[model samples]
Target: MSAAFDLEAIRRDFPALDQQVHGRDLVYLDNAATTQKPRAVIDAVRNFYERDCSNVHRGVHALSQRATVAYESSRTTIRKHIGAHDSREIVFTRSTTEAINLVAASFLRPRLQPGDEILISEMEHHSNIVPWQLLRESTGAVLRIIPISDEGNIDLDAYQGLLGPKTRLVGIVHVSNALGTVNPIKEMIAMAHEKDIPVLVDGAQAISHLDVDVVDLDCDFYAFSAHKVYGPSGIGALYGKRKHLLEMPPFQGGGDMILSVRFEETIFNEPPHRFEAGTPNIEGALGMATALEYIDGVGLEAIRKHEERLMKEASLRLPEVPGLRLIGQARQRAGAISFVLNGIHPHDVGTILDQEGVAVRAGHHCAQPVMQRYGLSATVRASFGLYNREEDIDALIRGLESVREVFA
Candidate 1:
């Protein structure tokens, strides 16, 4: 552990990490799915419901005023966290999936012409892939995939070659969920920009594990989920460049996304608010901001170093397990690692590990194209979070041994 990273103290911040499961101390390694929330975030959510519960932007009462202030304050915090220029660039959505969908429907759909291209990678989560597919089906556009290498690295040469005149937008994942590949998105974004193409990054897996600066990357849009970063679920944010957000139309129609409405024509609101249609997740935003503050309090650089160390340890030890085959040999990896055990179904591996109080994900991890590339239906994924420890990796290895014994 780094000198600044006090593992024991950090673990204590997450109340969920203190419990036992299946008669053993729980070892949670499924951070790619969602992370365990710290106490500060939980209290933020609870406090909102307990005291500051009220509708925002529509009421003048004290509770509503307080709620509204805290809610919008979160948007500012998120903007700062990602190094976005303005809070108006931050639009809240249900999750990363919805954020992408909003971009597809409101931003790209208007500009897309028949036979125009939307570029993405083979390692994308379904959230990144399906929206573009839906756009293609509806608009007669073409969806192009940037192939990944055998080692799970995106082929940059291929990516550069595909940025042709017909390409409308580039949607990429900063950190792959299944493979743990940390893509060179900054370079990729620059390549797309050379051709005057805008790029949208699926940052769901990157927000907690990496230092994301939207301005530094110059990406047109970035989307991430709160739950994956130890915040509440059902709330996420989309960071769009101010120009794009100003140009895009409203995604949904309801309470907050408009300035005025008439039966003939409804006048829409400005960017961010224009895309955010409905009452919004009031407490969720507060909790999400609190979660980001918690990360800041702990120091993101130290957390990064700690996770990298744990990942290196896991890399060294996991291959020692009998019949284990580590997946995705990308030179740069983040909080996720995947592998398969010979002749054993990944679901079975997950079940056996669960019995030993080891939690892991066993599936294609919403990246079916990645599995298809490797000729696999599924693989066992062990992901890390800021709260994870060296002992967790040991427990996972011991649990894999038990799996081997049972199968034998």
Candidate 2:
């Protein structure tokens, strides 16, 4: 196997990285927030607007047919990407947040009764938390949190005891955005299956780094953001089993999601279309196909191997800064480091790092409860992706060392 990837070839595809930031060559460690798009994805969206700018599904004209074919073809592209059983199981949504809300609203709401529980992790993004809170409020179902240890890894022994007859659903992140913990989702899913409870794995952080197959995982549902996975914004997809998606109520009601309608009565369409409504984001979906294509070309194993190398280097070097402490030291972590420095607020660390031409995410990272659990308001987070290299990690260390020196 080749020990190298053509980094320059890969870097040239992202136009945003071609320029300077603060008079310095950009380091772009902010990938966990959103990835920079490839030229292919940009062109895919542009091509749709320039040539096939029309509404989808209903029009008999050529432009509409053009739009419909491109838009629907993207669904097939994504269905194959995640290895879902059928394209009909894929439903387009606004983003991961909207996708999770779709399941919480359409499926969980009706099935949940009083005393039924929604099991989620303490490390979940706020997107995973709020929807279940709404479900609890609406259905009187209890919300049970699977706690994490000091290193930010979930306690599986504790989680197993929580999984019992009353557990209606298990929603957990495939990777923790803040902690960089790659969750044991396959085992988690298998355990949930034994209990006869359905599971939904939030693949928002995992899709960029690992292979994802909904059928292989045997998950009841999976949700992830297109933007996070090198696709365009305002679009994402949900993979659900056909039977479950067919039974769930439509998350939103509008045109294109229905088979037939009247002023007096109406009927919704089959699984995928039943969940997608209104004027869909046709261009965004097309761009998602481009992003998926680019990722496939790079190969997920290559991406993960590169990221793991970066993480290994960072793990060895990060603790060397005087007064710096690392959080989330899970042995099975992906490419992230959430750290704190003595006598410096995480926000201050972020601002100072920004001034030094280094961009890193800081704060609770939408995992405030985890922050509170660790007695921290926040910590500075630096997450790695396929594009990152040893030089970036070196720059991060040098930047943090400057902060340590100045603060002292």
Candidate 1 local lDDT, 171-279, one digit each (tens): 9999999999999999999999999999999999999999899999999999999999999999999999998889888899897999998999889999888888889
Q: What RMSD does each model have against the real structure?
A: 1.4, 1.4
Candidate 2, residues 244-311, lDDT tens digits: the string is 98789898999988999998989998889989889999999999988998888888888888889988
Candidate 1 local lDDT, residue 10: 86
lDDT of each: 0.94, 0.89
**Residue 311 lDDT, candidate 2, scale 0-100:** 87
Against the true structure, candidate 2 has what lDDT?
0.89
Task: Name the 10 consecutive residues with the lowest summed lDDT in model 2.
Answer: 1-10
Q: Candidate 1: which stretches are off by over 4 Å?
A: 1-3
In model 2, the clashing pairs are none
